[model samples]
Target: MFLFKKNKDLLEQYTKYLELCAETLDIFRKAIAYSFENGLNEHFEVLAGKVHAMESDADDIRRQIERTMYEQSLLPESREDLLDIIERIDMVPNCADHLATLMTLQRTPINPALKSEIMELLDLAIESFKYTKEAAVDCFLKMEKVKGLKILIDNNESLGDKLEHKMIRTVFAENTGTGEKIIQKDMINQVGEICNLCEHVMDRIVICSIKRQL
Candidate 1:
């Protein structure tokens, strides 16, 4: 009875860990939008700071989850799966921080040739993470919903990839200075990578779901 109750408490902690992961992803999504929507001015720095803090807090929770799993002797399969999911989810915030830092250091105006294409990629990338959060929540709250959310995440990711390629081709075609072309390509790659990270995490979430069933 004591072991069962202890396991229950650990499970509750697991749920909280997932909540932090979701919150971090949402903050990352907003940070990306704010960077693009308002431009990287003073206000952007404030939003980025918030994201940084949240990511830090999420990291703490992730460590706590790890410790709890070990202390309580969680099943190895579920433990490993959950750890993988958390690690992948961490990439979302890491990407946001990297992108924010890059923009702060470089004040390159959005390229006219790829502005619309870039914004389209941002929307698709944000949606991908948005659905990623849902799929993660579904894994915890409604395991059966995981498969459907997985499909939507994949679709969003596919469209994001196409837009990324389109934006890149547009960037190279701009007939700009070589230095300028390189900077713009780097920016586009970072943005596209956020979407890619979402799909990567979703892959882990799907695996976790399968482990849950087994």
Candidate 2:
């Protein structure tokens, strides 16, 4: 009974960590959108601070889980799976931090077309995080929803691909100055990379859910 309670507590902590990740992703998306649309440079700093806080929170959760496991002599049947999921969840915040830092360092307003593409990528990435959060929640209930999440993942991936192609075309066709073009390219790539990472985490969550079911 004590072991069962400890497992429940650990799962709860895991859920909280997922929620924090989702919140951090939302902040990241909004910060990028605001920067692109309103020329707000301060939002980037805010986003970075939030991501740092989220990372700290995730670390705390991880330590708590470790402590709980030790105290209770409890081990997950698939410790590696759980560890992987936790690491992925933590990675979301790290990615956000990277994006924010990149924006701060660049200190240049993005080209309109490139901004549009990045905004689209942020939207899709946020959506992917939403579905990932739902999938994580479903895990606790023993509900298998990988099919639904896979659909979202596919949709987001398609959006990312289209945006990438459009951005590349706009950059070269417009003959934008080489320096600015490179900056835009880097921004687009980072945003797209975030979406890709989100998809990877979702895939891992699907695996973790299936393992739990088995």
Candidate 1 per-residue lDDT, tens place, 1-214, comes to 1222446665566566656655655665565566556777887777767767877887787788788878866667656766777788778777767776666668664565676777778777777777777776566544767788778878877888888788778878877888988888888888788788888888888877776666
Question: What is the lDDT for 175 in model 2?
Answer: 61
Put down candidate 2 lDDT per residue, 45-153, tens digits, no spaces.
7766776677677678777766765555555555556666667766767787776777777676667767656777778877877787777556545466776877888
Candidate models: Cα lDDT each? 0.72, 0.71
TM-score of each: 0.81, 0.83
Number of the top lDDT candidate: 1
Model 2 clash count equals 0
* Candidate 1 segments exceeding 4 Å error: 1-39, 140-142
Whole-model lDDT, model 1:
0.72
Root-mean-square deviation of Cα positions for candidate 1 versus the true structure, in angstroms: 3.5
Best by TM-score: 2
